[model samples]
Target: MSSKKGGKSKFLSEDLNELLNESQFLKDSVSNKKITKRQKNDVTEEESLAKLIGQYQANSKKKKLDVNVEACKESRQKILDVMNNQLETRKEKSNNLLKNLSEVMVQLEVDCNAMKDNEKKLEHLTGAVVKCMQQATTAHRQKLKVLKDIHASFKKQCEEMEMDHKTETDKLAEELEDDIKKLQEKLISETKRSGWENLRRTIFHAMQNDF
Candidate 1:
């Protein structure tokens, strides 16, 4: 009985020691696994911090680019507005120039028409003057011919009157000369007869006285 008890006690002691050794091994394994998991968690935390910093920098650059693009859009809009205003001004100027040219053309056409009318009037006046001058010349020529004919007739009548007056005076002078000659002969005969009768009377008277 004593030996059996001793053997049983020995067996119990061995089993207790085996169980304590297994407990210790399990504790060590759990401790080692905890350290490995802690190391992995530390590495993951470092990688996460680095990725967050890089993302922050990239976001800042993107915001700056977006601001620059917005400013460019605003500038482009202002330039377009200025160009539109200039185009409108040029169009107005061109329209005014065209209107002025049209007015000038109208005035020139009116002046041309007036000049043509004046020219036609002048031509008519010239023709009237020429016709009047021709009539005046013809009348003057006819008057000169009539005066010449009158002068020739007067000269011929004066010559005929002079010849007739000379012939009548010569005939009267010849008749007067014949009458004077006959009267002179008769007077001489009478004077001689009277003288003979006077001589006879004187002789007869002397004889009577002597007796």
Candidate 2:
């Protein structure tokens, strides 16, 4: 009975040793799993940081490109404004030149018209002067003709008066000579009758004395 009691005690001791060995193995496995999970979390955090750095670099490059493009646009706009101003100045100058040319042409036309009017007036004045000269010359010729006619008529009247005076003087001298011859013939006849009467009276007286 003492040997059976010793065998039972040994069996109980072996069971307890087996249970302690299994509990130690389980504790080691749980500690290994916890270390692996912590390593995976650390790797995920590093990848997230690298992605954030790459995004910051790309944003910086895009900002620089945008600034250059804006500067180029502003320069191009300034050049275009200068060109427009120059074109406007040229247009104004061309319009002024055209206006001045038109005014000059109008003045030339007026001067030409005035010259034509002056020529017409001069022609009319010349014609009037010529007509007046011709009339004066004709009047002078008529006056000369009238003076010649008056001189000729006066000479003819003087010659006729001289001839009439000579003819009257000759007729009066012939009548006086005829009257003197008639008076001499009557005186001779009266003297002869008186002598004959005296002789008769002397003879009668002588006869009486004889008786």
Candidate 3:
């Protein structure tokens, strides 16, 4: 930003300089034009004055001649005074314009410096913001990692619990199967004893009937 302001100041300076040059050129042109016109007027007036003096001298040899010589001198002096006044006014106006331009240039320079300072401050603020964002991102990543670790641990625990439950269920199933087998063997033995007792009773009753 400072660089950009510097470039802008440079551009403004060039434009101001160009304006100054153009103003100087215009002033010079006006001066030259007025001087040339005054010189032409002076030449014409001198010729008229010479012709009038020749007429007066020729008429004086015959009689008294009345000539407003003082009036002519006064007119010339007034013309000179007016021209000088105009020149001085023009010079003063040009000086004023130059002064105004100089003030504007100085103000622009001051504004450019102020802008450079503000830009530097903005740069610092931007850096701080970027740093804060980076810190927040780092913290977020750390939290995400922690959550992942906790999830992994929880999953591992769940898997271990499921395995233990399966092991206990299998043990219970085996014990139930052993109990069922023992009950079945006891039922078969009771049936054989009852059938044998019935057979012995029948043999004894047949022997008594034959006697």
Highest TM-score: give the candidate number. Answer: 2
Give the whole-model CA lDDT for all candidates, comma-separated.
0.50, 0.48, 0.53
Clashing pairs in 1: none
The parts of candidate 3 lying over 4 Å away from their true place are: 1-125, 197-211
In the range 121-188, model 2's lDDT, one tens digit per residue, is 55557777656655554554454445445434544443454444345434433443343344333333
N/CA/C clash count, model 3: 0
Candidate 1 lDDT, tens digit per residue, 66-166? 56555655655565566556555655665575566556545655555564555555555777765665555455445444544543454444445444534
Candidate 2, clashing residue pairs? none
Off by over 4 Å in 2: 1-39, 125-211
What TM-score goes with each of the models? 0.37, 0.38, 0.33
Question: For model 3, how big is the CA root-mean-square deviation?
Answer: 70.2
Q: What value does the lDDT take at residue 35 in candidate 2?
A: 63
Could you tell me which residue pairs clash in candidate 3?
Answer: none
Error of 3 at 210 (Å): 7.8
Better of 1 and 3 by lDDT: 3
Question: Candidate 1: which stretches are off by over 4 Å?
Answer: 1-38, 126-211
